[model samples]
Target: MKKVLFASTALIATAGVAAAEVNFSGYGRFGIGYVEDRSETTIVRGPGADGLNGTADDVLARSTAQTDDVILVSRFRLNIDGIAETDGGVRFEGRVRLQADEDASNGEANSAGLNGARFSVIYGGLRVDAGNVAGSFDNLANYYGNEVGLELFAGQYSGVDYNFLAYSSTGSGANAVFFQYSVGDFSFGASYDQAQATVIGAGGTTSTTVDADRWDISATYTFNNITAAVAYGQTDAGVAGVSDPSLTVLTLGGEWGDFSGTLFVADDATQVASTDGTAWGLSAAYNLGAATTLLFTYGDGNASADTQQVAIGAIYDLGGGASLRGGIGRNDCDSCASDTIVADFGAQFNF
Candidate 1:
């Protein structure tokens, strides 16, 4: 449920004083875990001939395949929203979030993990946001639904990883403008980001960076106890030797009694030559009692990068703004040719 909060002072319609309400909120989790994957090359190259780094031939290289790491991990987020209405009834809303850094390694707080800010204007069912916002695909079921084992099967998207459209508002760092409108049981949203990904080319010891942009649109319908949504996105390859990237996702979600689940299918094409990505995933939840719930999630990806994952978790409400979380899962990917084995037990706090 969305929370609406009032400002400390309730002054309204006064001399030059605007009536504004501020809402403060966020969620966090902490746990111990281990992960590893090394089926495919996890390396990225800079100034390397193989179009990859960290190999035997690269000057600077990095890879995501990790065999092991520290087990202690934590996440934190904070959001402050300012809202006010003009005398003519136009609504103005601004948000600043203190979220985790997207590229940060484990157990690090550089500059207190501050993300960016965004603002929105709303009139009736229409709303728009600018500055540090994400695209419409962020609201997809597999992206937004309950996830377990530290977001093994869900969470990050691999197919469309080049731009803000792939990450949405939650993906740490891409900034954009977002638009949305709602009428009764139907709603639509769109977003655009300039230079979300930069084209890079090695010029001897020099590298070239080109500017590009991306955009996405999504629509959703709610009927009875079900909601269905579709999102499409495209990214312009700002430089030569690159193909324009595009993605499409379809999702169906519903609740029958205490059982709720989401089924989603996605297809992605990026600027990389001769490469394709397709995925299907499902997530479900059931309440076991007043304060306990069970969750399950699974995902399978096709193409050169065949991947699959499944997880089951349980959440126990502990009252007073906290809950107990536990999950176990396994994931394997072909392109990177790696496997992730996971078991996570933690506590989450919401405000």
Candidate 2:
């Protein structure tokens, strides 16, 4: 993304700071996608034991069938960032985003609008952020290095299953606090988030409050052209009958001339019985020329069955902050009657 600076005298005067700067930047992507095993459910109604049509006793059943469909996908995001520095060298900053996504079948309409805000304080190599903050788990280096496709989906190796807080783009995220420090080739981060909601009784005189809390920590170190990172996170459910989830992950990645590769493993207990074990993945890319790169990725979910995926793709530079990318991948899904095939082609640009 490229940043465009704002030079409004009114903004500087209103901030009353020694120096202030504001900038805008973001990206947009659009593409077509196909799924070989897409499916949908249909409801059928029939007479019950009474054996009478149009009677009160009727049965409804749901049946699923493969759609094997294709669809269009797109997204646009705009980021606005403002910073002000005091004479003492301390800097205060704030950021917000406007984002929109294509409305596909069964997808909700997401119109562009300003979502949540994050405020930060920065000094030297240390920074602190509050409100709509990114959690430590999601901020780990190379955590999402395996992502591919137009939608940037991580096939079988989902690093963490939303067990940690993330910056929300369409709404105010959890009340959160995060901090990070970097020195030389070492960096560390930690975050905590909480959300609560009150439910009112039918009579409006009784109410109950439900609370959820989460926290995570991460550290990264680089040596000899290799970077290693570790992240751990836990979530506590304050509601009855809800199970807590936890995740621990490690990642190692490096760039060697025209070749780059990353390896990651994660142990997660997210209450999803099918994906609860230890999962691992590898992602690699090699530059074929000045304008193209070849990519490959593989992952083993370590589940009871059908727990693997492999994909190959390429990226072509279009120059001027634009590129064309595509990939074809297969997922060994346990629930699918057959292996699922997915493919996508798209163009992306940053400004």
Candidate 3:
């Protein structure tokens, strides 16, 4: 009986090893900041905030700051991904993420959050991806520099920083269907999504509902170091009081020796009451050496309360998946305060 049990355990272990595969890769960034002028009327809020009533003063007055200098942390994330294969050319992949300073505050570190997961199958001339992931219509545009700039035209408002028509909210995990056809450097694809919005509020309370349906199509052409693409997207909101929004974007991106840049423009078909706006952004990065790089960006929006920003930054790789980054940015707004400055420095590590 003991020999039979041992043989069964050995067989199971061998099968497990044979059926499993492992790959690990992730990136992390962390830093400290000091904003000379944090006196803005417009406030930044969490993704769950109700309206645009929150202000920078609300956050700064509550958080601890030192004299004219305040400690700030921004955009830190750690992610791990895993994949396992099954029968019939089918595969499953999952990812988990930890965000420390998503709020750009110096407070306690936030916990690990689920980024996304997906299941896929492939055959000749056809591929299907169904699960929770970034949508097809999402714009891959950089609206600002590495550290302190904001995405003015990312959403309907100057302060809103997401291209919702292009990207679905991932609170409850949206369902996405994607189809693609490829031949050489020319390819085309389309995606459709129908997902329920994540619900907040306990007991009886008023909550903002985001039941959005979206569709997107894209085509790309590539030659040498230059790649250009055009994409169109639209979203229909089922919830009342929210306007259905549609957007069209054109992007041109390329990489040359030691230099890379992306230029993007997006026009919003339906704008919010106070913010009907079109947005444009330009971002470029240049490598100075094996250890140093430079980045610059500019973004502007056409809201009645127009906003614009400029940023410049430098990063130095320190080996061992660690680096140093710093930047300065200036923001000017018509509705909010006229001008503000942001400065930050930080070190990052990954394993």
TM-score of each: 0.79, 0.81, 0.70
> Total clashing residue pairs per candidate?
11, 0, 2
Off by over 4 Å in 1: 1-15, 36-70, 100-111, 141-143, 150-172, 196-198, 206-211, 240-242, 271-275
Q: Show the lowest summed lDDT stretch of 10 residues, model 1.
A: 1-10
User: Model 2 scores what on Cα lDDT?
Assistant: 0.78
Q: Tens-digit lDDT track for model 2 on 36-101?
A: 756676767776555544443453677887653687778899998888888888899998999998
Which stretch of 10 consecutive residues in model 3 shows the poorest summed lDDT?
148-157
Q: What value does the lDDT take at residue 246 in candidate 2? A: 84
Residue range 284-318, candidate 1, lDDT tens digits: 89998889999887877666554567778888999
The residue-level lDDT of candidate 2 at 309 comes to 76
Rank order (by TM-score, best first): 2, 1, 3
**Best model number under TM-score:** 2
CA shift at 276, candidate 3, in angstroms? 1.9
Runs off by more than 4 Å, candidate 3: 1-19, 36-69, 72-76, 86-90, 102-106, 122-127, 139-172, 178-181, 196-211, 239-243
Q: If both were scored by lDDT, which would come out higher, candidate 1 or candidate 2?
A: 2
Shift of residue 150 alpha carbon in model 2, Å:
2.2
Q: RMSD of each candidate?
A: 5.7, 6.6, 7.5
What's the TM for model 2? 0.81
